[model samples]
Target: MEISRRRFSALGAGVAATTLSGTLSGATAAQAETPPGKPAVRNVVLVHGAYADGSSWAKVIPLLQEAGMNVTAVQNPLTSLADDVAATNFALARQDGPTLLVAHSYGGTVISEAGLAPNVTGLVYVAARAPEAGEDFAALSARFPTPPVTSGIITSGGFKWIGRSAFLRDFANGVPRKEALVLYAAQGLLSTAAPTTSVAAWREKPSWYAVSKDDRTINPDLERFMARRMNATTIEVDSGHLSLVTHPKIIAGLILRAAANS
Candidate 1:
């Protein structure tokens, strides 16, 4: 299902045209403009990564809702890749029509497994992992200089998280001070045995990526490499790892682009 660069270029051009027209409002708008027999995407399923929950998508959710999209933010268990993917699939199954699957941080890994669902038409990775099938994301990330936040991850018993200090300084650096503190207090943790994937849906689905230029959680270079390798439509934002919070408009715009293109 790998798309040729030429095909992606053509797709990107079409998306750019739709975006410029400013007519997209949701699946309805896409449907009205679509050529016969094309899928119209209106549903969006969001997945959050380690150290966060579904609330991580709070900012982007309202924006998408205002655009007339039916949005569902999944509450991943973060216990294992299988459990998280199951949670995403549960959300995906409720979508009435084609859906745009969006992921942040480790949530990207969840969507990589669950996005193969029949209703999923596209994927948007926001400063998130886009591991190839059978690829070890940790090993892949090792190719780039490790981001400072990785060193701050603290594991106890079987779960992993960053302390409030590390969360504020490294994980949510660009976030407002007060809000970063709140996010730290509500931090989630991942199980020690969370597995990587061998079935990345981006292989067949059209994908978009948002790279945080100043990201300290995941290296920007690593994000770029994964985006390029997946042939995703990529947008770069100058923000921290939590770009979805700091730059909701940009992330929502990318999702809309994926919706139009789907």
Candidate 2:
């Protein structure tokens, strides 16, 4: 079933279809000086998670750039955690000033590490994971209901991908079927071997989270736990896991908020 747009308007502090709360993510407002001799910028770097490519952010980019913000989407190789982090850092290195590092899904894990780059001023997590340093993500996920997407995994040559049926049904739950097909066609594969982070950037940098209330890929409750664990400013949208694709403005709005607060 598709979620209605009206559900977007119902924001609150409870586990409803939509929610927004200024919970403590334990982050501070103190601004770190831009690197000496480096000019600051209102830049945004987007990171896409497994089973997807940078094109996933196509809808959100225009909105951000139109608002006079510099935007770049990182093309993660999805081969390993280190490779994805390197790709993100490379994008950050190219930014002219303080940047908001944003991620969707597994991409959340990317920013949690790359965000430590001195130029990043804030973080935005959209229906994404925000694991602590050395945390066993699989173990953590196990604490929640197993997402059916796990059954949709297709593995070959040590790389893993989501089956088209599952991508449309679960991973891209609320996205239009046609667009979800395109996303599946443009999807990338992740390594079968699990990747972990050494540090959690949300612990240091101010953070914002957009929870996909109707998400089927990751347990909705788990998303809330991560957002509250980091004490992030949080919002819940009545959409699926691909909120970035289905609700670009909402994601964009959160990024703008992060930019303003950070």
lDDT against the true structure, per candidate, is 0.80, 0.80
Per-residue lDDT tens digits for candidate 1, residues 213-244, read: 88999998898888888888777777789988
Model 1 residue 68 lDDT score: 74
Residues 79-124, candidate 2: write the lDDT tens digits.
Answer: 8999999999999999987899999999999999888999999899
Clashing pairs in 2: 12-19, 24-231, 25-230, 25-231, 25-232, 41-97
Model 1, residue pairs in steric clash? none
Q: Judging by TM-score against the true structure, name the best candidate.
A: 1
The per-prediction CA RMSD against the true structure, in angstroms, equals 5.6, 8.1
Candidate 1 total steric clashes: 0
Output the TM-score of candidate 1: 0.86
Model 2 worst lDDT run, 10 consecutive residues: 23-32
Error of 2 at 209 (Å): 0.5
Worst 10 residues of 1 by lDDT: 23-32
